[model samples]
Target chain A: MINLKHTKMKNELIKPQGLVKNANRRQFLRMGTMTVAGAGLLLIGCNNDDDMVPAMPGMVSLGTGDIGILNYAYALEQLEAAFYAEVIKGSYFANASAEEKTIMGDLEKHERAHREFFKAALGTNAIGALEVDFSSIDFSSRTSVLGAAKTFEDLGVAAYNGAGQFLESADLLLIAGKIVSVEARHAAAIRDLINPGSADFAGDDIIDSNGLERTLNFTQVLTAASTYVKTEIDFSQLPS
Target chain B: MNLIKLLDTICPDTKSAEDRDRFYSRRDAFRQFGDFGKKVALAAVPLSILNSIPHVAKADTASLIGVLNYALTLEHLEYRYYQMGLDSGVIEAPDRVIFQKIRDHELAHVRFLQEVIGNVLNGTPVAEPGFDFTAGGNFTPFSDYPTFLALSQAFEDTGVRAYKGQAANVKESDVVLTAALSIHSVEARHASMVRRLRTKKGLDTVKGWITNGSIGSLPAATTAIYAGEENLSHGGVNVANLTGIDAAAVSEGWDEPLDMNQVLGIASLFLAN
Candidate 1:
């Protein structure tokens, strides 16, 4: 039996982890959006710093059902696209080698395309541009940048796997499967960059003894991703 | 309730009711295979459930092997592909470890599938056939690095699409579906690594993911893998109208799947017979 305990993967994607068998309203609030500048953050709803509630003022409810999951993915792509866009915006990172720069640059376009596709696929249902908070990531260092990339890539892969069971439509699942593997490829590339000369691309952290990649539920993902995002997300439509 | 609707309870994901007839014929096709056929026939019928999951032994037995074998054939091809690359002695020193690791993963997948399918069939099916990377003397992939990178890209990209295409049929068996997807992601990772290597060597300027027909047009011999990938439509919906994004990027964002026949056709190019 595949033991799914709602595991929270420990990585740089989110800060501070506490294990919970399931995600309730309290846990949902802890999940935040990741921010990147132009071509990244898209805020869907209102924001009230002073008002504190489970739905949270200015926080966007990922909505319910499949639409919500699409929104959730859209939000993550926004975060990743913005992060990479910012990475190249500066001095092209003096520390990054020429090869790293080219690959990372290419990565930015891929992420941006993903963000836009979800935006298109969702159409009227697409969430507003998410605003990511990147204060925690050190943009100047290659280690910091690639570390963030690795986390996003792995998280994206895990996210798709975790969400697979929740999806009801075969068409959606097929597309999701298509995208997840691509993300896995990105994860491998970033892993190679961060730690070359090793097979750590599918390291123990993401894979199990069975050679299967680890997965995370909506609640688990929100709990960790919330730290980097300014917009609060209500996952009421998703599994608790 | 019938087994499939009941299955909808635990699975929470079910395709439309219209697809039921399709399942019936699929299961019926396997009925010619002796006891395995009978088991598959029953598993395909959604009329009743002795238990919620039916018989695990039965479900994993018959048609499942067909899917597993399909997977194994590809894995066998991929495993040998990297193995041959390593033995060719043409891979650069820096990238040698990369190929070695990928080779190990493919071998693991081959072993994993063989182990499962072999257990079900009570014996291993068959050994891998000989391969021709050059595709009937069409080109020289081994001698030249650029040629090698292009072919590597094709294999990895095809692997991704191949897995995606078969997912619908495999989803019926929970264990098999999950395992297949696990391998699918690894294949995706392999494809990505190979693409990055291309860019590093300046053989190609491409995105991490296959876009609007695999970075750029591939040679006609290996073009089958990417045939339907350039479509910008998701279902009936055009991505551009939906998101206002460029049609090309919209198509690039999602990699499409290739049916079993399409995959076999591509894989056959490398196989000697």
Candidate 2:
């Protein structure tokens, strides 16, 4: 009975909000236009919405249960990896030296690996690729780009730390531990690049005088995430 | 209510009522009644009695989950703060990059948590809630960069300590524990960067994670509260009771952890008026 209640509760939580009324209207119009344009493509190979990449601003449905959370992480890695790749590909920074370029490349590779690893783990349940809008970034300047890099790396590290406690499975936790540490290293390296002699990265501020790490709840994290993702995420089903 | 009734109310799925009755029978009836009466009376007591009972929820396995939620909440706060900073146009070119990167990192963190809850924990990620960064205008407005930095410093410093405080909850799960701590270090790095920025801009950066103390000068109240307690400090440093960290010792490297109640209080700063 307890398990049944849990299941029911989860189902209610994960039920995707039917597309917001306004969004649905927009989507209907867009789909109508696309259908006319791609009728030939559809006949040739494409199926339907399943094959179509989810539109921008669509929530990444993690589904119900633990699998949903993993999908969520996978979805995020996809975004990060894609962003860094573009940043590197554009060579957005002015006066980019070889060393900095190499580091950027490494970061890109790590993000890609992170994305792929999750995709492989999730298999069929993996989220569809997302379309990112980076219009706000001024990629031409080194300071602008690297500064953003530092923020991303740092946020990644803290997110992992905060989320680690909620993991129930030992195996998954182990995997997360490895990935989070790597992200931490990334954060440290980025911090060092931004400001020299300031990598006193792991101090009482983070660990506390008691030698412990900090943690946060999912609702808090998702709210912060909402702005950047452009996609609305519904985490209503997660355990309180 | 009788003890059996209370137990049933709390855990409705016990294997057998007989088993529960038997379990309660092991204790002295008179003594148990006294304890139960005390609990009942406490429940009816007003806010004044709160301190006495402390409302300290007993530590349980679920605490691990609670700690994670707490950490996630901090990331959400940071992400929003950076996003607003970037959009405000007050931030300069270099600062804009910094804020954007922070924004990305926060988004990544949110995604990571979403994955863990859905996959490993077999739970759905919690829905996002509305957070008011302005804490009822208790402090300076976030629209000002200096004010924003101060709040940022508080958020980052608190994040560092919150992770540390929750570290023990994950210890039984070594993998999760290590990952949590790893992230904790990264939060410390973020706090340091923000602090440096504040200092560079001629703000009082020392009030953040470090305090000056010597044979000549006594620690401030904030410094004193955090003195030797850096291990437990989180989010906002008790600026009035600050303490410095030794650059040498590994364990002593971070600031002290704050009490969970203190953390929640500070978090309330971001709540809407």
Winning model by TM-score: 1
Tens digits of per-residue lDDT, candidate 1, A27-65, equal: 465455322221211322222222222344565656555
- Looking at model 2 chain B, which ten-residue stretch has the lowest summed lDDT? B213-222
Report, in order, each candidate's fnat.
0.48, 0.11
**DockQ of each two-chain model:** 0.28, 0.05
Candidate with the greatest DockQ versus the true structure: 1
For A38-72, candidate 2 gives per-residue lDDT tens digits of: 12111122223332323234555454344455655
Computed on alpha carbons, the lDDT of every model, listed in order, comes to 0.67, 0.51
Point out where model 2 deviates above 4 Å.
Answer: A1-57, A199-213, B1-273
Cα error, candidate 1, residue B188 (Å): 1.4
After superposing candidate 1, which stretches have Cα over 4 Å from the reference?
A1-56, A91-105, A123-131, A196-198, A208-211, B1-61, B120-127, B139-147, B214-219, B241-248
Full-model lDDT, candidate 1: 0.67
Q: Residue B197 lDDT in model 1?
A: 72
Count clashing residue pairs in model 2. 78
